[model samples]
Target: MKITVLGVGGMGSRFALMLHQGGNDVTLVDGWQANIDAIRKDGIQANFNGKPVSAKMPIYSPAEIDQSGVKADLIVVFLKSNQLDAMFKRVQPIIHKDTYVLCLLNGIGHEDVLSKYVAKDHLLLGITMWTAGMTGPGHVELSGDGEVELENFEPAGEAFAKQVVSVFEGAGLNPKYSHDVKYSIWRKACVNGTLNCLCALLDCNIGEFGKTKQAPELLHTIIDEFAAVADKEGVNLDTEEVYNHVAATFTSDIAGHYPSMHQDLVQNHRLTEIEFIDGAVARKGEQYGIATPYCKLLTQMVHVKEQLVGAK
Candidate 1:
């Protein structure tokens, strides 16, 4: 299989390495100039599973992708939710008639943007439990085990989706073809809306926040709001189940880790996907005449933090 991985940051680089090791022809596309130059000079420098590993493969910027004449059978996207539209437009030349574009981005409503770029049969959306960390350009740390649950955007596209699942399986990606992936995406959103947002706000890691006496109350408040909004969006989320799923992550193997939002807004001083996560829920809540005080306040707080840090 020939694959192109967009946004070759922490998680993106991890997936590219795994698929390459699985014997697929994998190329990378990223917007960061430093990352592109570093990988072009030294391949990918990875501390994978606590071992130093290096692999050489082609890497390109989004602009370089078209001129390089790369035609990909599969394009697995791992960009931040905000970067989706522009990146897709830049990579238009590589998207053939039958190419499968799988979105493993976080939060909700990505399919809305993706549908504008590709046909429904060629689109797949999912959530991944995979975690990764970037130390520098072209360097990443990958650890632990994660699974990906994805489904075709259209019911008639299942056959191709199964083929993509097989390819992911060969890469040890632990792929599951889901009939109800919307529920899964919303469940994962609950995890991010609470853990990611609160951790970034409190300036703490997952376990540290979990140890606080108010953790459960905070989790319920945010998750109940998410459940209300998700219901309005035609996805019925089990509030208890979603709460437990998120609570478990506080003690999971990655408990000490700061989530991606923290890495962005707090440490790196960058813009976050707040609008896609809790902010998305808050908007839906307003549309449905439902109250989402927690989400609304959290969304505002994250933006304030962004402004304070002068985040781009």
Candidate 2:
């Protein structure tokens, strides 16, 4: 399969490397010059299960997309929510009518942005629990076991979804087709709303945050807020179940890792996806006359932190 991985950052680099090594023709496109340059000079350096794996695949910046003359059978998007629109537009030339665009991006409102670029029939909405972090330019550290759930939002995309799934499973990506992926997306967002944001705000990894006594009380409140918002949107989120799912990330397996949000707003000194995650919940709650005080406050605090550090 000819695939184009848009936004070759931490998560992007991980999947790109796997798919390429799995014998698919995969090319990468990202906004970061250093990442592209590093991959071009050497190869993407990645560690999986405590073992180092290296592979050479063509990596390009957005400006070089069309000139690469590649028509992608699939476009796996791993972009941050805010950067989706412009980047998707730049990669449009490769998206033919039969091409499937699978978005495994974090947070919400991504399909709204993506729908503007591709037909609903060509759009595949997905959520992945896979955790990957960039070590440096063109380098990533990936560990732990994670799977992805994706679905076709339109009947026209069903066949495409199955085709994509076969390819993913062939690459050992472990994918399942979800008839209702919104629930999964919302559940993952709930995890991000808590672990991703709180860890970023405190400048700590999950282990450090979990060690604090206040973690449970804070988790309860945040999960309640997210549950309320999700309920309003018809996604039934069991607070206790959701809380447990999120708390599992604090174990020794992924405890030392800071989530992608922390890597974005802190390590990389860039803007975050809070607006599309917690902030999105807050907005939906507002529309439905539900109060999301926690999400609203967290969103405000993250924005303030972004301003303090001059994030864009």
Candidate 3:
């Protein structure tokens, strides 16, 4: 399959490498010039399962492809939410009628924004529990063993969803077709609501946070509030069960890893997804007449930190 991976950051780079290794023709795209230059000079480096390896693939900046017309069967977007608008604008020339666009970003509201730009038939919603990060320029580290779930939007169906899953699964990544990707996204968001923000606020790794005396209680509050909001939105999720499932993963397999929110704060980059995760809960709480004091407070604190750091 001809695939183009847009936003070749941590997860994007890892996906690019996996696809290439599986013998798919893959092209990597990112906005950063240094990372692009590094990948062009040396191969894309991925540290998976504690081993370092490189995948040789063509890397391009958006500018390089702007003048040359190019398209792909599939374009997998791994950008942060803030970058979506610019990515969609730049990829306009290459998006064809049949080009399938799959977004694997965190948080909600992505599908709404994407629908404005692309046809519903061409859009695929997806979520991943796999944890990865960019260790340095041109280097990506893979940390977790969760699968990827994807489903077609209103105009697409199960067959289209299966094709997308098959491509990723063939590349050795666990991929599943979901009839209800909305619930999958919410489930993943529930996990992130507890782990990501808490880890960022406490300045600790997943295991350290789990072991902290206040960790479990704080996590429970966040999960319970989020579950209430999810219920209000008609997405039924068992808060306690999800909490246990996430806690087990954090304590065992992903003990040493820092959540992406923590990494963003440490790097002094702007953290906007907090608005979607905790802020989303807080918003829903207001509508449903539920008080989300904790979520609202954390949302404010993270915003203040972002302003202090001058992140956009």
TM-score winner between 1 and 3, please give it: 1
Give the alpha carbon lDDT tens digit for every residue of 179-210 in model 1. Answer: 99999999999989999999999999999999
Expressed as tens digits, the lDDT of each residue in 136-215 for candidate 3 is 78988986686888888875555766887888888988998887888878888877777887777777888888887887
TM-score of 2: 0.97
Worst 10 residues of 2 by lDDT: 245-254
Return the candidate ranking by TM-score, descending.
Answer: 1, 2, 3
- The candidate maximizing TM-score is 1
Q: What TM-score against the true fold does each predicted structure earn? A: 0.98, 0.97, 0.94
Q: After superposition, how far is residue 39 of candidate 1 from its true place, in Å?
A: 1.0
Clashing pairs in 2: none
Pairwise TM-score winner, candidates 2 and 3: 2
Q: Please report, as a residue range, the 10-residue window in candidate 1 with the lowest summed lDDT.
A: 226-235
Candidate 1 backbone overlaps, count? 0
**Candidate maximizing lDDT:** 1
Off by over 4 Å in 3: 268-270
